[model samples]
Target: MDREAKKEAFRKYLESSGVLDALTKVLVSLYEESDKPSAAVEFIKQKLGGPSLSEHEKLQAEKMDLQRKYDELLAAHRDACKELEELRNLKHEGDVKEMVDNNDAKEM
Candidate 1:
């Protein structure tokens, strides 16, 4: 679409989303400030609770948490596998010793 059409669509969106109202209020407050800010950008940022982390930052934090959990689970799985192997070896050794003892008894 043309630039005017895009602008109208964006304006409608901002109004519908209440962003226009919020921004207007913030701007009005800034205009009434006694100690006006040097930078409008900083004033807006401060008005809007300072700079906030975007969704990407939040997702990265969640990803790191999941990664940590996955690492822990993997380590637990390795330990369980090692324990299972040791148990199997012990059982095998016991079976072999029992078989040798039975053979000696039969010969006697």
Candidate 2:
């Protein structure tokens, strides 16, 4: 309910979830860097396992390309299935007609 209590609860949550440990390790790595990055926030972000903007963009492009290929393959599969069904129907009609003709010839 009070500010100190809230702070203690937040600290406990971070420790229990291992956020404190992970952040400490990342900070230690940044401290040990001989050539410190100009963008310290971005460096910390990357060290915290977040993707950089360029990597995120590249992934998005790759996802879009894969989706396009998937759509093309799906369309081709549907077209092939439709053609197969039409051929099956045509063959069935031909077989029925041939049987009827044979019956008529036998009757004659």
The lDDT for every candidate, in the order shown, is 0.90, 0.96
Structure candidate 2, residue pairs in collision: none
- On the 0 to 100 scale, the lDDT of residue 83 in model 2 is 100
Clashes of each: 0, 0
TM-score for each model: 0.52, 0.89
Candidate 2 lDDT by residue in tens digits, 1-108: 999999999999999999999999999999999999998888889999998878889999999999999999999999999999999999999999999999999999
| Full-model lDDT, candidate 1 | 0.90
Error of 1 at 93 (Å): 0.2
Give lDDT tens digits, candidate 1, residues 1-108.
999999999999999999999899999999999998788887787677765346447888999999999999999999999999999999999999999999999999
lDDT of 2: 0.96
